[model samples]
Structure formats: C-alpha cells, structure tokens
Target: MEPWPFDTITPEEIDALTDEEKQGLDAAVAAYIGECLRRRGVDPAPPTSTPA
Candidate 1:
C-alpha cells in the first residue's frame, strides 16, 4: 500500500477525505501498527473466540 499521502492531517482534513482515501488511510494505519507489534514480538492476530 502507498504511504499516507500527507505528513499530518487535521480533523477537518480527515473529515474531507473521499471514501476511497479513508479506506487507504485505515489500511495504512493498520499495516503500521501490525509492523510495530511484530517488531516487539507480539502477535498481531485477533484473539480466538471463547466458547460461551
């Protein structure tokens, strides 16, 4: 995925993003957080569901 398009964004700027842009931003952030977790030896996967 391409890097975030802007260095920084204001709330208004985020609010103005097109739907596709918002999806891209969300993906970029998720990817970045996953990488950080991996670097710290943490599993990035979602926790397994427990039986009720």
Candidate 2:
C-alpha cells in the first residue's frame, strides 16, 4: 500500500485489495470507527450478520 494519508485513500487504491483482504479491512475499520464513536458517546447500532 502507498505511504500515509490512510484516511483519505482513494477508491482505486482500495480496489487493489483481494476479496478476503477487502472484507478484513472493512471489519477492522468498522470496529475502530465504532469504538471511536462509542468513546465520544455515540452509540453505534449492534452488528448483524448474514450466512454465506
């Protein structure tokens, strides 16, 4: 991945990720953002899952 500016990454860069990598990144970022929101008194909705 390119160096720095992670928060402003472009879609073309994200498109380089494999399916599994994309899902993993999505989950990680979601968790991090959710935690940050909760820390600031914003209650995030409960996570839901669907069977593959």
Q: Which candidate wins on TM-score? A: 2
> Candidate 2: where is the Cα deviation over 4 Å?
1-7, 46-52
Give model 1's TM-score versus the native structure: 0.65
Q: For each predicted model, how many residue pairs clash, with residues at least 3 apart or on different chains? A: 0, 0
Candidate 1: count of backbone clashes, pairs at least 3 residues apart or interchain = 0
Q: On residues 1-52, what C-alpha lDDT tens digit does candidate 1 reach at each position?
A: 7766676776689889988888788778878988999999998986366222
Residues 1-52 of candidate 2: C-alpha lDDT, one tens digit per residue: 7766567788788889888888888889888989899899998887687323
Which residue pairs in candidate 1 collide? none
The CA lDDT at 41 in model 1 is 98
Worst 10 residues of 2 by lDDT: 43-52
TM-score of each: 0.65, 0.66
lDDT of 1 at 21: 88
